[model samples]
Target: MTNYHDPIKHLNFLRQTLSLDKKPIGFFVSAGCPLSVEMPKGEWPLIPDVAGLTQYATQELGSKDEEPYNDYDRLLKEVVKSEKDPKNIEDILSFIRSLKVVAVGNDVRGFNIDALSEIEKNICEKIVEKLDVDLPSENSPYHKLAHWISIDRSVPVEIFTTNYDLLMEQAFEDISIPYFDGFIGSRQSFFDLRAVEDDLMPDHWTRLWKIHGSINWFQKENKDVFRTTRTDEINSSHLIYPSHLKYDQSRKMPYLALIDKLSKFIRKPNSLMIMTGYSFNDEHLNDTILNALKSNPNTMVIAMLFGDLTYKDDNGDVIENYPNAVKLARNRSNLAIWGKDEAIIGTVRGHWHTMDDDFDDSINLANSITFVQKEGEDGEETDEKIYSLNLGDFSKLGEFLQALIGYNQTNFDEN
Candidate 1:
């Protein structure tokens, strides 16, 4: 199940995409990878939001400390038992959100709607608190990334991210890099769907689309959306918290429009998408990528996995080193995979291709998929490099961005 690919091959693919004829290039940054920054102590929770609720339910709920949390615990246990892949905090919260309306009719001995609501609220609060990381002050990596985007006049760019944090926004603001987020107004910004729908974006201005909801974004009683700097308004926070209902949430206003833009972007001719920090675990997101590939022959997707990709086997056995991505990349000439140690490039739909024996040829095969011609053996190509981080370290985002900056700098210097 190993999906590891050579970093060199992956970078070569990236260089080609940057050089594509595509007018405006786009990139995706998943929460899996973020600018490396230390989260402030005591400001965030140490355990999963569900875990905290479990403890509260067991302890604060009197003699039957577990009674209050029994329903949630049961749901979590069932999810663990039923899911082939290991579940995360988001998975647990999402399961709870799904039960909001569907859990009607069937009741055990009794059903306490109030108790369930309280638990849900607590979970959401815990997550918001946990994610309220202290923004990086001096020498922020996101600042550098923004600066790169601002200076790279060679191609127009669009940035899409699944992260709910304001780090990127802060960086862009700090550096005065002009960009559009589909929200307008100097006082109370609202979702300008018309601008996005009409494709009024300028090629020089970078467009940032947060596919998922953000922490600062809130809704008023009248349903007007506004951005804020306050983190204490739990009730006002309108974010699409980690929940199974995310797909449904995405169907609504801003998300729907934003997602549609993503779909359209990938289906355009001469398009290339560079995805990082995303694990492709979300079925909806995976579907979007797969559909984009199927719809456009000239479009290509290059995904970089930050860790060892793993998945469950047919028999539900946990398979290590095997990435779930292989299922999509397999036999797909438009999709290429790069991980810590291995590389899989699109080729004739037959045997699995490995670069272990022939690294140079593998690079050539990857380049060929994007119509990138390699110079002679002695010809110098732009310097590209891959960066890695320790397992489970989200702070490595900073390091990854720094590596990206270095990689781009090398290319700029050489070119």
Candidate 2:
């Protein structure tokens, strides 16, 4: 069968053809990306306290507590049932959005591990495992790309991620791959400054821009000063939760300055962008991305569309076929799609099957589908067959990155 996971071969091919050095290439990751490695089975892992707030809100709303019921839950139930008025639904969503992190924390804390049904407990355990484990070095596509870029090209790479998880950061660290995300600083004044001085920054490392903030990031005092990841107890006040208004709130000076810096990076001429596991749901993020694309016509975007590549609207009609795939296809003049048919196999497959029906489980299932096709002698057609680990699987991540590097090197040679 054809191996779809062969990223190196593909990279070599692209390098032989494309003019890469004329442009800078970047990779953007969203939280939904399945960049994580398999976690070992374990007991209740410590859920971040930020997730506990969700449970607190749920219990407070459900019980006859002294805390005033904002009718948030009732409105949510109504909204789900489609019985609530549009305005009421909007208001309820607004409230829920505001309380998301708190609500997530509370939800985790509320789960009675001992009392849970086997399947339910398994689901919770899986999420905990996913949260705790670092991204697998061998399987992570991002790292693979980083390795290729580091070895093949002289051009600097910029990594922009919206995930709060440390998977990407851990990958870079594990490989001794230097990176900057505006969080690192000197020991003497580290506690005071928000970012490392431009002069002290290394030339070879990737510059990471955590657009949606990070789990390890926190604010200090009332000032706009920030802190990097630490081994000590997490300060609950520092975590930035994902919400609809997050981008708006970030528009305040400090965040605005960061965004300005990030924007300039993207606006640079001949920039190629590759996006993975991003759902394109955040309007503010979408606007920024669209603006960047519009600003540079030579820019190219390669997006991976995961899952069934289909969707249904309110009326239960398939108004948009291949919703995720199609939306991505329409967005850019120069774009390539991947991950429509790549599946996780071996031990990872077994692990996913053991998990309960939850977000993590669903993600695992989605990651299990692989790309397949058939070929025949000469130009003749034959029965189509599914190909595994060809150019689309996680294993090919490094190869893909290498291909970009090769392409860039070719351009450099030509010039």
Candidate 3:
């Protein structure tokens, strides 16, 4: 029970490796996990959770008695079964968008663009509305993350999020932290590919790239992208429409430049990345990380998964029983993964492994003491001083960041 609930060992390992002088470390945030966690009553439903999205999807598809609605429902089920990822909203949006395209010019007879677009708009609206909510005063992980980045005044942190929500931006704003989002000017924020690709971007300025288009983005008559707070109507939004086609669309201007930055950043020596909330659902993004691991031996990724890891079988069916990251870590010595209480740490040898099946070899985060003690020693107190750590809560971003900050602070005091 303690193993599943504790994260101190992993946090300490992270603290030891982190340095302000190392190559820029990036944070990759996704829609699940952090966003899915319920906020306090006053801040309840700050972002759309999985259950809400599921209900929204069901409602959008309508009743099973309706043939068209049933067809859409079947489509969603098929994609889920094929991908073996339950939180795969991108695939669903992509299929609907494709159907709309094929429905043009007698390309398809049954699909309706208006209907599909309606559902897409509904989901996007909810995201935008909730994202714009006021920031809560609680121990927000985003604030802690920003605080961590703020500590290294010499270099700014790079944050890349797949979510369209403004949660990160809001956190930064609330804390008065400055960030560049590839948009130039103030009155009207427009896409600036030049600024994003600029080699002269100051190291002290944090960089945020939303690889997936945000809900505020809309293309005008001149084809120029504009940001707006108007969520009343968004059927014609310029957002890439939350689809797998994002990979293809990503080849275009703004997205292409942003993704290229990620690729180049990770390829640098000593580069480290903390990837959270992502479910490895985006193949393109996963490919980038895998390439980095292969090309940059010094690069490391601490991928934290909130749910069970999954991998594909020989028949290409997703197998949920195995820890996907653990298997991947075994093959790549530069990667470490933490999910719930389980973790696979990289080894001195050219392999990845855990302390043991029971995790006795790992440090106990509570008091920095392991359950495994001297074999012959009776239950007696040792004279050695043991550094203890208290993780107020576990398995949440706030707790993780708190532990990390505390560990770093301890080191600072000792030095």
Pick the lDDT winner: 3
Which stretches of model 3 miss by more than 4 angstroms?
1-10, 36-38, 41-45, 60-87, 112-119, 126-132, 230-235, 238-240, 244-251, 307-323, 347-397, 403-415
Better of 1 and 2 by lDDT: 1
Q: Write the per-residue lDDT of candidate 2 for residues 308-409, one digit (tens) a residue.
A: 334578888755433444554555555445444332211011101111222232222223323333557775556554433233334344454544443343
Mark the 10 consecutive residues where model 1 has the least summed lDDT.
365-374
Candidate 1 C-alpha error for residue 46, in Å = 12
- Computed on alpha carbons, the lDDT of every model, listed in order, comes to 0.58, 0.47, 0.60
Greater TM-score among 1 and 2 belongs to 1
TM-score of each candidate structure, all chains considered together: 0.69, 0.59, 0.73
Clashing residue pairs in candidate 3 are: none
lDDT of 1 at 125: 57
Off by over 4 Å in 2: 1-22, 39-132, 136-139, 186-200, 230-236, 244-254, 311-325, 335-395, 399-415
TM-score of 2: 0.59
lDDT of 3 at 38: 51
On TM-score, the candidate that comes out on top is 3
Tens-digit lDDT track for model 1 on 193-256?
Answer: 8998886877767888888767667665565666666445434435555432533332357777
Model 3, residue 208: what's the lDDT? 88
Tens-digit per-residue lDDT, 1-415, candidate 3: 1223234445545556554444567888777635544577675556665556655556655465655555556556655655644354556666666666665555333546665656566555555544556546535777767776766545567888877767788778877777888877665577877778774577777898888877677665455666666544333544654544432342256667777888877887777788777666566877777887889887888776664344568999977543445556667878766554245566311211234324432233323222323233676765432221222122255554645554554432211
